[model samples]
Target: MDINNALKADPAPLGLAGFGLTTFLLSFVNAGILSGSAVNVVMPLAFAYGGFAQLLTGAFEMRRGNTFGFTAFTSYGSFWFFYAFLVIFNDLKIISIPGKALGIALILWGLFTLYMWSGTFRLNLALFLTFLFLWLAFIVLGFGSYYSIIELTRLGGIFGFLTAFFAVYTSFGIVNNSLKPGTIPLGPAILK
Candidate 1:
């Protein structure tokens, strides 16, 4: 079966929703709105929805020939998987990851996001804002963890909340538009 012809639905909404919800939950803990123990609930959700579901969405995007969606969904999905495993391993005492190392990893992710944000110019305002906030969140979180600064971490959490909001709004707009075209305005692309 030819996937390009067989797959018709847009998968971005699923990917965005998964990422947004997971980020929102984790950000709650990071922002100090919830206890760290809340991660016990978030871990499984990250593994199941954020990781697995986004991977599925990425595959669909590939079938649709959307390179940006494929990359974004797959990479972030892998990130969720990495996060879930990191927590699991730490809990099991299988391997210990230093805060500095985690911070460096996050900074690297931020670098990746920064480049990805450049691509959003050709997309829409929703994606532009989402990537912008996401990049900021990662950088702040990376610095916070690296320097053991609680305030930076909290600021990152605030950025994470903003990222999640835009992502969720984009997802909702996409889905709504699918059902009723022009029901939600995604705004014009910054680039022609």
Candidate 2:
């Protein structure tokens, strides 16, 4: 193998896994399958695995000149950090954020994800589906929080579960293919 290829590793799997697991845990709470107290369990996972690990993965992607990976991983990683801190500060009574304000933030994230979804057309189906569901989740959750609609929030949680599943599946496929090519399939890119 070339020195460069040997030195660099694929970071997508790590980033995806971190994002997926954390999302799954949080989604359970959002869906009301778990009580609010479950957030205490999710906070540290969000900070460490989803936030920090994905940040590291994004750095690796940057080193590999994968702009999409770098942007996606880093952005989501920062999202995790934001989420953890938001909950922490609220619990500590350090700061209180109105639901409407948080809703606006989520809507902004949805806007970002919608644009990012455009980039996914050149990628595999796994990534495309992941982004699609994520965008839907953000929009539904944003509106739900904004309007204080419980059903919408539950629906958003369902979307989050789908997003997490696809992300985790993509990560598994990539890792499996690395070990034994074609052992798993990530459907072809839509663009080419």
Candidate 3:
């Protein structure tokens, strides 16, 4: 038996779902579809699916030797965990994070995501679009907080919703392609 030949399921779907669901839920809050207090509704999902499950997905991706999947899943997992902690803390009044601080964090994340977005040029269109929208979402959210603009936040929510939608679409593509190659088109890799 060749250990290298052992069957292992793809981890991308789980990672994408973790990202998509959490983004969708939080987008609702950001878009004002749900009250800001409704962030509580997202906390548990963030910890379970977005935090733990995506981290596990990243470990599996590492086992599969996919550096991008490993990095994206693990980093985003940590993002969800930290985000939940921040929300919970604020909800409980354990500490307060200034709007500027949150804005700075969002800007930093946007920069990081922008870097990742370039790498996705070598990937598929679906993933590339996902990162692109995500980057835009982060930028919009950052400016919203920094400027105290509700309209920007609402725009961010629209971009975030697109990001989540693309994530879900990419996840579906991964699963369907795995089950039956060419069953769903992810578009050709652009890099090469």
lDDT per residue (tens digit) for residues 114-190 in model 1 = 99999999999999999999999999999999999999999999999999999999999999998999999988889
Higher-TM-score candidate of 1 and 3: 1
TM-score of each: 0.96, 0.96, 0.95
The lowest-lDDT stretch of 10 consecutive residues in candidate 1 is 1-10
Query: Candidate 3, 53: how far from true, in Å?
Result: 1.1
| Number of clashes recorded per candidate | 0, 0, 0
Worst 10 residues of 2 by lDDT: 1-10
Model 1 residue runs over 4 Å out of place are: 1-6
lDDT tens per residue, model 2, 1-192: 797885466889999999999999999998999998999999999999999999999999998989999999999999999999999999999999798999889999999999999999999999999999999999999999999899999999999999999999999999999999999899999898
lDDT of 3 at 179: 84
- Please give the ranking of all candidate structures by lDDT, highest first, separated by commas: 1, 2, 3
Cα displacement (angstroms), candidate 1, residue 157, comes to 0.4
Model 3 TM-score, all chains together: 0.95
